[model samples]
Target: MNITWNKRQLELRERFREVATDLVAVGSDARDRDASFDRELWKELAAADFWRLQVPTGAGGLGKDGWDWLAAMEGLSLGARDLGFLMSVASHSGLIRLLLTAGTPEQQHRWLPGLTSGEVAATGSTEESGGSDIRGLSTRAVPTADGGFVLNGAKAHITNAPVADVVMLAARTDTEPGAFELSLFVTRTDVDGVGSGPGEDLLGLRTSPTGPIAFRDVRVDADAVIGGVGEGLTRLYNTLAYDRILFGIIVGSSLEAQLEPLVRQLETRHAFGAPLSAQQYMQEKVVSLTMAVEGSRALAYRSFGQLEDQHDGYSLSASVTKLFASTGLVGSGLDLVQAFGHSGYESGSAVERNLRDSVAFKIAAGTDEMQKKNIFNHVRRAYRSGELAPGSRGSGT
Candidate 1:
């Protein structure tokens, strides 16, 4: 697959880079230190149409598809240099992806405009008890005689929860013993019986607000159902697969942006009366980082291609990409910190922040263990059906 961007894509990326540097990067360090979320900066991004990059023209969005959106996000990652902020963006994009793929026309009309105009959105799937285990989720939405549902449960560790205007959430709609029956719903946070807690102080990605959302007899109209009732699992997983693809894209592009600075540091920093660049060990670090960047981008692009085509293997490809990209990012982040020595280790330094932020990639979207399980399950099914050859799953098609 040719990974080179066309001229327009390149230009879009550059434009977003400028936007990130000017609007998003400013006060990023302070925000990280204080664990703050800047609403104004979010609005700045909206004013620049950053959220519309991937929206379809028919949906009253900018007329670009997934490829163009990926290019714009690549630029944002390069220029922002703030992973916490990017994490927030990724979380918001998850909701957008769900709407674009599965939303009704009325849903899109009501939410898309606000979403593109800086009204914060969040996806509530991971519960305190369930994490990424959908079968374990307990939030319930019981149907009322009027055809509406009364939602009663809470979502924990949700991004943007503390300030979201709306949430796209999954809740149990059936309770047949030992069965998993869920439905997706969209609701305004300002409505009665909905509440959000204070943001949690985390080890990393502190700049992005992460918190809990609660629903106590929250009434939602029948129109709030997304995809359909009793049909949420498929749509949920599809959204998740898309999210994993995004993780690969974000990690790959962010690492590429760090490459030049790493090169400069190695060439200029002397140790043992010679430049660090002269040391084979140091050179190996650069080589590892370069490989990670390339590997991630290749898999990301391939999986995204499969997703756009609605290929049956998209889920498997997406899982592999997330597993590989997250591992590579955390490992390479440490390599960068080690390369810079004390300066890199200094608190509030860019490299140190990067190292901290990179840790979340392993745990968010889906954990590495979860990805492995998904990969195994998908490959086993294919192998059993005689659809895949012995070694072809790992062939990276």
Candidate 2:
């Protein structure tokens, strides 16, 4: 928990914290009331190189190891109340990785600079009605007479739909199941037939600009296909592997951030003729929840290390981290709400916001159930393959 950062990372993390706190002060109320999108804050991040923190060095980015970047990101996420902003930044970070991983040199040179400079917004598209299930996305691309292609189908839950200029999108390029069947295409958001719906009325992260859009026969040149046709899944999967681990940091640290302030309140305020902290039962409850926070922090940091090491086992590591962190969040959140009695349960308090937001953590990036399922699948692939044991389910552990 006392891990020291090098001078460069320390400076970067402190700057992010200062700026993020300022942004929260300016944007939190507006976001809570109207689900406002912080265009100005996004511009500041771009100027500060926050968007390019994970980009390759050649792409004009800081290019820290993925884990180091997560550490920096968690520092910003700690005590952060702007749900929409955290989700937005995290989503864009994933898209940046997708571009850096799959873009050709020429393509990288042409687009990455703009991304790093904040001249454009970036996003990825792959979700369908079934929640971005790899095989369930039905977006399609047809060859054009001029060596380009026509894209059709809509993407729901597309993040940053309102402002993104470059999108890493996926679609069916052929009927086969080959790696080439599903290709990744980069499209200009300003292209013809590109339009977006309003953000949703969500229980949390409402400030995020989530929406749906139809391709409606959109056009793209031949050079837009990243890593060629049918390599979309590979590219997307690689980006999300890094993305999911960061998700644990964002979710875990934010919960910790929210709970810490409330704990101080409990320490100062009396509930039954004595300060909540003085009551044995309340002390026990707060310590118990603090233990959950410490565990979440440990797992989050551990997973980030695995990611930076380029561990082949990061997928499983991420799943375990997320599973532990999120389950702890649910428990810790309940403890937080119950501790304040009706005061915490009412609207307007930070605890209420954290409570709503924590519920959403059970589902974002990857759900608790999804993490367990992926862990089980990882076990099967890594251990149970070719084993002939009867009814033996391999443990992902």
> What lDDT does the true structure give each of the candidates?
0.90, 0.71
* Candidate number achieving the greatest lDDT relative to the actual structure: 1
Predicted model with the maximum TM-score: 1
For model 2, how big is the CA root-mean-square deviation?
3.7
Clashing residue pairs in candidate 1 are: none
| Model 1 CA deviation exceeding 4 Å by range | 390-397
The number of clashing residue pairs in each candidate reads 0, 3
Worst 10 residues of 2 by lDDT: 388-397
Candidate 2, residue 239: CA error in Å? Answer: 2.1
lDDT of 2 by residue, 1-397 (tens): 2345677777767777776777654658667768777677778767866667777788777777654566568767763577567877777777666666667878887777877676545454546566636677788899998999999888877677766776767788885555347788877788897777666677876777777767888989998888877787766665666666666677666766666666787778886797788878777766766666676666666666655565666777777777777777677778778887888898877667766766766776667787898889977875657543666643322
Question: Which regions of candidate 2 deviate over 4 angstroms?
Answer: 1-4, 62-68, 119-128, 145-147, 177-180, 308-310, 382-397
Lowest summed lDDT window (length 10), candidate 1: 388-397
